[model samples]
Target: MSDLTGSTDINTANLPIIDYSRIEAFFFEKTAENVAENAKLLRAVNDVGFIYLKNHGITDEKMKQLFDYAKEFFSWPVSEKEKIESCESKFFHGWFSPERTSKTRIADQKEAFDIGDDSNLVRPNQWPADWPEFRTEMNYFFEKCHEIHLVLLGTFAETQGLPKDHFDSFVNEKDHFFRLLHYPATTPDSIGDRLRASPHTDYGTLTLLFNDNSGGLQIRGKDGQWLEVPPIPGYAIINIGDLLSRWFNGSLKSTEHRVVEPPPEWSKLDVEGRLPPRYALAWFGNPNRNAWIEPLSSCITAESPQRFEGVWAGKHVADRIAKLHKDGKAPEVWKDSMYREERPQQQQQQQHAQLPALA
Candidate 1:
C-alpha cells in the first residue's frame, strides 16, 4: 500500500475532485484489474487526512437545493424552531436550537440538525411540514447520501488493500449520522479555549464531509500543529476515523481537529464584522450494533497481534462519548442526573465485589 501522508496546503482551490465515474472506476475494479496511480490516492489520505471529491455521483443541482433548504431551516425564528428542540429526544441527540451547544466542552458559536441513516430511528425530520418539497428533498438527500456512503466504503476497502467487498458484511446495517452545521457570525470574544471541536477522534470508521467554500476545518499534523483544510468545490472531504485508524495499525492517523471562526478580511466594512456562516454536512459511518470490530485478520500478523479487543460498534461509541461529556471533556451530548446518579452505586458494588474478606 502507498503512504497515507498528504500535502499540508491542500485547499478547495488546489484539491483534486473525484467524480462518480472516477469513484466507480477506482472502487469497483476487480482485484485483477490495475487501477490508476494508487500512490496518489494514498498520499491524499495520509498527508491531508482528507480529500475533496468532485464528479462524485451526487449532482450540483441537488447540492444547491439542499444548501438552500438548510439555510432556510436554520433561518427560522427561535420560537418556531424550538418546537422540535433537540433536548426533547431521549439522547440530547437531535435538532439543536441555535447557540444551544458548543464543542463537547468548549462553546462553539454554531447550531445544527442531526439525522441518522436508520430509517426506523430517522423520523421525517421536523420540516416545516407545510412545504411539500421539504420531506421530498430531505428523503432524497438521505437516500443519495446512503448510496454514496456504500460506494465510499468500497473505496476505503480498496485503499486498505482489501477486496472492495471487505466492508460489506459489517455495514449491512450501519448507523450513519448526518449533521448539518451552521457556524454563525463571530466576534473576537467568541473564540474560547482554543477549541472549535475539542481534540477528539471521531468514533466511527470513516466520515464524509460536505463543506462550503468558506473553510475553517483544521486537522492536527504529525508535528502537532493544526493545519486548515481548504474547502475544494465539487469535492466533499473524506477522512479516516478511529476504527479505520486502528485497522491500519497506526498507518493512518485519526488526527485531532477543531473549527474556528474566520477573522475579518479587508473586504469587511466594520471592525465587528463577521464572515458568512459556514455550512458543512458531516456523515459519520458505523457498522451494525452487533458487528464485531476486531482487527481485520489480513491487517495483522503474529508480530503485531491485535491492538484493540473486539467491540460492538453501537455501545462502544455511545460509552466513550458519554464518559467524555460527564468529565467535561466533549460537549456533543448533554448528561442527565439519572446517568450521574446511578454511577456511584454501580461502582461501589463492583468495588465491594472485588474486595477480599478477612479469613
Candidate 2:
C-alpha cells in the first residue's frame, strides 16, 4: 500500500506496475494505507490506461496450463484449425485463422480463438476435435478472470465511495469474452504497413491480458510515444476500455494500443518451422446488454459536465465488434442471438401486440 506517487508520473517513461495484494485489504479493512492503495489504483487507471498488477493470486502453475493449451491449439495445422472456424458456430466462438480476419487493414499473419458467454445472448461454443480438455481448462480460466474482474470492480466502487457492489448488477454469468491469440513471426523485412493488430482502442469496459512473454504489445502514451510493455513474470497487463472511459467522462482514458511486428529475439524458439509465434490471452469484461452506461455523477462537475450519452453495454460492444471484425458478421448463429438484425416489421408489430397494455 505504500504510495508510488513518483512511479505514476508520465515522465517516468514506464507503465505503472502495481502490487494488487494490498488492494484487497482496502475492501475489508479500509485502513488509511489500504485507502491510499485504492487511490493509487484509481490514479493509475485514469492516467496510465495500462498497468501491470502483481500478486493478484494467479499462480505460475495455472498460467502454464493456460498457455500450454494455447500452444497445443495453435500447434495444429491451418487446415486442422479451420475445422472449428468461427463460421461454423455463427456465434464467433471458434477459431479465426489469419485469412478469416478483418480487424486489420492489412492481412495479419496470425490466428485466434474467441470464446465467451454461451447463455441466451450468444450461441454455444465450438470445441476443437479431440481436445476435450480445452473446454474445461478455458472455462476455469474464464471464471478465474471474472473473479478478478469482480474484485477490481469492487475496489473501483470503494474508491468512488459507492456501495461495494455498485457494478454488480451490470455483470451476469454470460457477460464476458475471452480470446486466445497467436501471432506468427514474419521477418522484419517482410512486414509492410500491416500489423499483427492495428492501433485501436479496445471496445469493452476493461481488458485483462496474459502475455506469454513474446513482447510485441505497446501502449500509446499521453506523450504520444509507443512504450513497450515487456513481460513481468506473475502479472497480467490490464487496461481500461471505451465503455469504462466513457463512464468516467474520459477521465480514465482507453489508451490506444496495438501489437506490432514481432522482433528477431523471438525467433530463438522455433516450435513450428521458422515461424516464431507469440501468444496472449485476452479477457474482456462487459456489462449486461441492458445495463446503461453514463458518466458517473461523481465524475461530472460544473466545469466538466457529462461528456457522453448513456449507452447499453452489450449492444454497443456487439455493434463495435461487427464493424471491426473481418466479414463484419458473427457466425450465422448470431442471427438468432441478440446480435441478430432487427426483426421484420410484421413480426415486430405482432410481438409488440402480444405485450400487456400499459396502465
Query: Considering every candidate listed, which one attains the maximal TM-score?
Result: 2
Q: Write out the backbone clash pairs for model 2.
A: 90-331, 90-332, 102-326
**TM-scores of all candidate predictions against the true structure:** 0.76, 0.83
Give residue 311's lDDT in candidate 2 (0 to 100). Answer: 60
For candidate 2, lDDT tens digit of each residue in 281-332? 9999888766678889998999988878776565567665654465422322
- Stretches of model 2 off by over 4 angstroms after superposition: 1-13, 87-89, 101-105, 118-122, 262-275, 327-359
Stretches off by above 4 angstroms in model 1 are: 1-20, 27-34, 46-48, 88-93, 97-105, 121-128, 158-162, 192-195, 263-271, 302-305, 320-359
Measured on C-alpha atoms, candidate 2 has an lDDT of 0.71
lDDT (tens digit, per residue) of candidate 1 on 246-316: 66664555656667653333114245554566788777776765555666766677786666655445555
> Considering summed lDDT, which 10 consecutive residues are worst modelled in model 1?
333-342
Name the lDDT of candidate 1. 0.59
Residue 212 lDDT (model 2): 80
